[model samples]
Target: MPIQTSANSRLRQSVGSPFLASLVSFLVGVSTLLVATLLIDAHLPDLSLASGQPGWLLTGGFLGVVVLTGNIFLFPRLGSVQTVVLPITGQVLMGLLIDNFGWFDSPESPLSVARIFGALLLILGVLGVIGFLDALVRRTPVVGNSSDAGPQLWLWRIAGIIFGMCSASQTAINGRLGVVLDSAVAAALISFAVGVATLLLIILATRTPWQLKRIDDGPNPWWMWVGGFLGAAFVFGTAFLAPIIGTGLTVMVILLGMMAGSLAIDQFGLLGAYKKRATPIQLLGLALMVAGVAAIRLF
Candidate 1:
């Protein structure tokens, strides 16, 4: 996951516009999947399966843009800790909702007292993992400016939460799409295709320039182009896993692994990330999250 994000970071740098960069990466990914599907003689997706309910598939692409754009806008304003942590809170909460209600034809993992406790612990763990708790203790902004003062800042924070909810809901919707299409890969590909179409419309509507000529800077590394493949893999994994594991568990496990990778990235300065050794509090946070997951799973 960190590798995927690092690739996205490099791609963002290579392409001046984040939206354009995402569109290009997703295009490469979907094209690759289409070719691979043909090569494998895999069952091509039945477009008819999507006839009655196109909105489910559209959620994946549309909400993805919301998240990408949300992160781009919120990170600077809310500080990295709040930006990352807040969305995670929303993801887990919304994921729990989906799981409890069995929304999107997903398996139900109804809420329980133990699960609620585990969730609270998980949120706290995330706060600690990102150093938000520590920063709050010191009365300092959490790892960025975070000084965007006003009622509007709260609005952006709420937007951040909504973006998080969008992510969790996207996973559930794509899972249902996968089931309907009878192919997780196909669902992921379709999701990426929709995202591409959506981005194109936004570009046209906003009068955003293509800026393709900027590639003249020089040939970008091959790894930078791998974002699309990584993205495809991620979407496919979530679509495949959500139905089997339940949305809440799926999101929890993903978050656990994501933060773990993030800590490694920070500690080792991997993928051009800033070098920062993991603090004891962060390690403790990871432990608490592990415990939280255990609590959720065991009960």
Candidate 2:
């Protein structure tokens, strides 16, 4: 979460266009994975293994692009906390459904009372964290000025949740791909490769430029360029972890880390993310999110 947030922040700070930032991030991520693939002499054989496999498995890359570009567009408008939390809430919910139905050939973990309770808690957490409840109680719009940005802000928040659902699906697909190829790293590489190809098509179709706009007054920091590397680590980790831990547990752990990291980023304004100190209600919301995940996966 931190890595993704940091990278999004940098792109928002330095890159003018969300489409361009998505392209750059994927390019860097793919390049890094390519080097690793060559160094390890990994047995990718994605083409040979492509036949007979469910077509949906390869869609991870497409979903990944959706998430990357969506996050880029969402971060500034929603702020760091909402950008991270909203999608994760969606991720958890979608992950539950994925596990229950064995979507994408993932292992089946049917929903139970505990799981439903967890989902409810997660929804409550989202409402609290996004200040929806507070606004409702106060009889005000969540974003203030219902006549103007209020509706737009709600729209972005909804998009963030949908993007998160894409993220959960991506994780499941990539995990299954990793198992098929017998190499998590190779799966990540293939995912990125497809993402790059998809992004190129989008850029061409939209006529988006390769040049990034300079948002910072001074020269860009070196760390900003490395967000993709961190993203690679995350993709590889989730791909590797999901099959072993089950999608529910995998999403739970990732969400826990993301919530904690996003809070720190919001409070400290790390990675050029907007600074907004978490309120007590927001902290309580975080606690609820943790409990919700625990109920889903642990209890």
Leading candidate by TM-score: 1
Clashing pairs in 1: none
* lDDT by residue (tens digit), candidate 2, 178-254: 88888788889889888889988988999875665555467777777787787888888999988887787688778
Query: Model 2 segments beyond 4 Å from truth?
Result: 39-46, 70-89, 133-140, 143-162
Task: Give one digit per residue, the lDDT tens place, for model 1 in 226-293.
Answer: 88888888888898899888889888888888889989999999877899998888898888899888
Error of 1 at 254 (Å): 0.9
Each candidate's root-mean-square deviation in Å? 2.4, 3.6
Candidate 2 lands at a TM-score of 0.83
> Candidate 1, TM-score vs. the true structure?
0.91
Q: Tell how far residue 1 is off in model 2, in angstroms.
A: 2.2
TM per prediction: 0.91, 0.83
